[model samples]
Target: MNIKKTVEKIPGGMMLAPLFLGAVLHTFWPGTGKYFGSFTNGMITGVVPILAVWLFCMGASIKISATGTVLKKSGTLVATKIATAWVCAFVFAQLLPEGGMVKTGFFAGLSVLAIVAAMD
Candidate 1:
């Protein structure tokens, strides 16, 4: 079986496939990565290398001159996403007796995670 061919079958597989595999490994054997050496642990920790390269490429490819245009195009989506998130957070906060999002709901700790991970 061609590894390249198999990976190519899944979109973004070059990046995501390995991530899924690692997640599965962790699910079966939690903290397995910590037992590995520093290098392996670092790589497994969060796919930092791939993330760095992805960020670098994303920034590097954008021409400074078109930055305004890029921002303009993305600004709408970003603003909308943030606005909706804030609205939801406000509503959720109101629901909570503490007047805040700390630990509540069937999804205990979910509100905090959602707010923290909310993206632009």
Candidate 2:
């Protein structure tokens, strides 16, 4: 199946895919990630390697002259996203009893990840 094409059909699939995979793994086999956390088989070996490579590729792809402009624009958008998420998190934190799932409603139960992922 064309997973990329399928995800692309849904809005914000880039972010949603990882989230969905996480949720499925957490729900069905909670210990799977930890079990895979080994030198040969890894899960939380973490995103550092991927991030480092991505950063290097991005740096190589961009023109030095455009770096400032790129940073300025992306920084503004990131700042705005952070501010908006902060407000939402603050509101939820004040309203909710604790980081538990709400059986009664959409956000009766919430987690720090849910709060932050929205911003991400």
Per TM-score, the best of the predicted structures is 1
| Full-model lDDT for every candidate | 0.73, 0.69
Off by over 4 Å in 2: 1-51, 98-109
lDDT of 1 by residue, 4-97 (tens): 7999899988778877887888789777768986766666676776578667877898999999998998898888988887777777667755
- How far is 98's C-alpha from truth in model 2 (Å)? 6.2
Q: Distance from true position, residue 95, model 1, in Å? A: 1.8
Candidate 1 Cα lDDT to native: 0.73
Clash counts for all predictions? 0, 4
How high is the lDDT of residue 80 in model 1?
A: 90
TM-score of each: 0.48, 0.46
Among all windows of 10 consecutive residues in model 1, the one with the lowest summed lDDT is: 111-120
